[model samples]
Target: MNFDTKHIVILTPGFAASEEDSTTIPAMQVYLKTLIKATPKLNITIISFQFPFTTQTYNWNGITVIPLNGKNSKIKKLFIWHKANRVLKKLNLENPISVLHSFWIGECSFLGDKFAENNKLKHIVTAMGQDVCKKNRYVFHLRKSKSKIITLSQNHHDILLVNHHLESEIIPWFIDKNDFPNLKENKIDILGVGSLSKIKNYPLFIQIIREVVKEKPELKVEIIGEGKAYFKIKRMIKTHNLQNTITLTGKLSRIKVLEKMSESKILVHTSTYESFGFIFAEALYAGMHIISFDVGARKSIEEWYICSTLEMFKITCLNIINKIENKKTRIVLNCPENTINLYSNLYDSNF
Candidate 1:
């Protein structure tokens, strides 16, 4: 099974339909572009297990994408996997795949396992957030198998080892500093990013905002992103009588989000769980103060105002508001180059 060592196949849940599409995973789009930039001679083929699953080949940023229609019901998706397998076999015959990289551990890993076994290709899965959680049943078998696994943070790495006896490569997600806009003058007092779903815990974020707003009457809070908890968050804001002080901007483009980050003073992330808080890194880079719970990003950055208790978070918020009025510089650092280098090194490896 000698093949072009530089060629690789990437499988993911969703990817941006194009550069302008903001709905896809931001990290995945960046990863694909960076892969091409890091390995100039590499050939990339992306297979998506998501919508518009037409069995056709299309080019996105010079990478070929093959989607087998899996956006249907459970039974249809099950059949789509076998259909995808046939499409993949044709791809291998045309251009031998060097490696199979699954972005998440469930269906992608299952497909990766079958594809690699048939093609005799090396395989790896990046165990992201909930994919390696207790409920994803595939973790135990995926870990026991020979397939290599990688995690974005040590928290998830430890979870894999403790729960499944799996040791995974720790590869942090890298954000190219050059991609971000320069920080502008802070216009808003607080900001929240990420979905408005239950796990994101937007209600808690609103509570923290409420706490800080009480201390600084002029300060205001803004949230970006939308989900099932939209009306729930709205109801909470109304119940708290924060109609004028708090604002929900709905979902915005990544560029627009960065622009908004530049205009904000603090980022309050109240999520109960995070594989890696990309917004924490982005907000920090934008020179905004970050107050977040003990999660994945807690271990990576040192300057963030990490809070363990709600009481502590409220105190931290008030203290930050005081600093804002007094005028103090925020702490921030550039993205980790080593993280990108590690992934690039993996791409360059023969295995």
Candidate 2:
């Protein structure tokens, strides 16, 4: 163990199975890689509670990862937590962990908060996605603990403050410019990327696209992702005879998805809620116009329009497709280093 290096433990529900497993959680994968590059002296250890369905420890991009394989079984949750506490104790003995950072405000945060309090160490919990808005009894425990809370965007911060009355720092996620390939020729006119979940509201996406194609019948659109809503969304496309207008490519690798964004002209995000839309940042970096509901960071970047209603969403898509609105390729948030620095400060803070 290197005494001079700082050891930071990360707790999450799941993580990439391997370096090649880019589809698991693309934003988290990018963030962790950037963190390592930004601070080479920092040591990162991940303890995933339930994912990859394996108990074996492995290395991901030089970072040590230990998966508990909880399998999301409520009957086994207590046993998993006890096992995780033992692992934390062992790691603290080895390197004296500087901080415990947990993703999401659920089980991981709950466990991290308890462990950090008992050990008198620093803990930080990031409210990711629906955790800020959804009902979670764990939030009450976290609010009482010494753990510092962080949110991804202003929208998320506000939601947390209003819903849970918890104050938090806002650190937006960024895209690494080096990961993108050279700009390719635009082959797709409209694009959508995300899980095919009901919360993503793909039905509204289909409705807007159905309207857009009435004027521009030859529009080329693609939705890249896979989930329970696949068959339902596919059936809707066929029912509306949009088989020629829209194509569901299912799920693609993160690199492939970025390539698709590069080859696309516009991105339509129909999600009902978003803590912070990482895809929006990716689309902006890929030089694509984005039309989405006023969710996530909702930064006022050029070529990105926020719509209030389905009619507005339809109009915005058509306007961009017909060139009624000017388009520009802009990178709104490009400083992953700043995000890393913010977390580094948090890890070193006395509070």
Candidate 3:
């Protein structure tokens, strides 16, 4: 290893388990990739420790990925702490590992804190939606950690402070400008991205589509991605007789999703909770108007129109649709290079 090049270890869920970015794996990859692209002065190596299910060697840009799994047993659950610390220790021996970062601060948080404390390494853990929202207060409180925990929005940070009794810095996620395309000459009606999960509330999105179609027959709502709530959302679409007005595009590549964003007039983020609304940031970077339910970590978006209830989301959607009809063009947003550079500096400082 180059003496000046820093080795950075990121503990996340299995990337091989899922397709990409939907979970922690790809999101971390995206951020690292952006950092490398925006700042070449830094030389960094990233090692990602995934769940036991992962058995593959993957590379992101120039970063080397090492996948490891944990044993499946009652003892294994209790022993995961030791197992994770062992893995981090083993990796540190090969290179000058300086910093340890993790996306979720619960299961992985303890592991990161343990590794950093044992080895005297700098550590940073981020609390995504599930960590601070879905996880019970008692559980989070019990797993208290001293590592700097990062949150994507002030709302989630407040939630963390209240629930976990911990203060978290708000570091919002960013979408690259290249991820978006020039606004399509002919705009489509609506686009939504996310798994067909219960928290996404796709059924409610369908109902809003039905209400929109009543006024504008040309209006359409297209949902991208499949999940546990897939068939349920489809059923709602069929029940509302929105076969023509609503469409589910299933899972799509990041570029393909961006293409859909380019064609759409607006993007709706209906998730009940999110750490940082990735799709919402992508939509904003794609220059599409967004009317989202006021839940989750959507700090990248302006808080001019926030709706806390389904009824409010419906009203806001209708209003945004009307504005879309009259506006000559949508806003184009460019993510700051400094934001990307921050990750690069942190990665390089790991040395």
Candidate 4:
């Protein structure tokens, strides 16, 4: 079937409620905004399956967004899919969608793959976060379908290949350097970002801090973001008597988190896994050293130190802190334009 090359539709489970809602998938927000700015002539529309909790269509940064308000109820998912199909039909009738891009390889991809197969449209599914590692039934369907698949990092691509024997393209998300603030003096000695969830492993972060403070009691540490594990983490902080040494600044805006990164010396990411840790790029751009596990897109840069064991984390933290004055702040990975160009080529290509 012939399709209009000027229009594209994006499918996702959730999206930022408003332009000001920075906490909800900030990386995706940066990517979409950059994509819009880079391609002025392209028409983009977003179909959010389970966010904003409203059935209202609105505009965000000049792009049209249609929220289905699925609210993530398992029993109501089929009804939501039916409504989404109706919306897509109306949208296609008005302006034929050239391509369908879904954020995760789950429900959104399932719907997009089916619709695209029926309508002869190109579909692309980007595997985000745990969806690649988890036991998702949609992976099997997508493997047998015609939709193109993309993974954020090499780690994610390997996992998808091993788990489902699926091949995918790698398109890492990048940070926009222009959004950062001026650097400030290093007031906080250490920093940790990401949700306070079990996957993030804030408990290991607290344990690392507890060990570090034994040698240098004047250590100042701060953790940003909030999640279901807040209370348990708080109790651990209190029990370790780290109230003075550590501060929990729960859920800061994207700008505020960048500001904190500017004033910090080092970033310690203890997460068990990451598809592509956006924080790693953000911290590196802020000129902060990163100490993380061998997860995500592991780079060979000197400042990004990857650790394997708890002992390695402790040693790396101490070694970096002892000579923190000698470290320099430099831009490592700020390639929003490159990412945009890659996606633009994919959108214009024939599947």
Give Cα-based local distance difference scores for all models: 0.76, 0.88, 0.66, 0.89
Estimate candidate 2's alpha-carbon lDDT, on a 0 to 1 scale: 0.88
What's the CA RMSD for each of the models? 2.6, 1.9, 3.9, 1.8
Superior by lDDT: candidate 3 or candidate 4: 4
Candidate 3 worst ten-residue window by lDDT: 324-333
Q: Could you give candidate 2's per-residue lDDT for residues 1-351 as a string of tens digits?
A: 232578999999999999999788778888899888777778899999999799999999989999999999999999999999999999999988889999999999999998999999899998889998748777899667888999999999999999989999998888878778777778899999999999999999999989888888889999999999999999999999999889889888888998898889899999989999999888998988889888997878767899988899888887777774344465756588788888888888886
Best by lDDT: 4
**Once model 2 is optimally superposed onto the true structure by TM-score, how far is the C-alpha of residue 222 displaced, in angstroms?**
0.7
Give TM per candidate.
0.92, 0.96, 0.84, 0.97
Error of 1 at 70 (Å): 1.7
Clashing pairs in 1: none
Q: Residue pairs in steric clash, candidate 4?
A: none
TM-score of 4: 0.97
Model 1 stretches astray by more than 4 angstroms:
1-5, 52-56, 299-302, 324-337, 348-351
Candidate 2 lands at a TM-score of: 0.96
Better of 1 and 3 by TM-score: 1
Using lDDT as the measure, what is the rank order of every candidate, best first? Answer: 4, 2, 1, 3
Q: Summarize candidate 4's per-residue lDDT along 1-351 as a digit string, tens digits.
A: 212257899999999889889878888998988887877768889999999899989998988999999999999899999998998899999999899999998899999999999999999899998888748877888878989999999999999999989999999999887879988889998999999899999989999999999998999999998999999999999999999998999989899999999999999999999999989989988989999998898798988999988888989999989983754576657478778877888887885
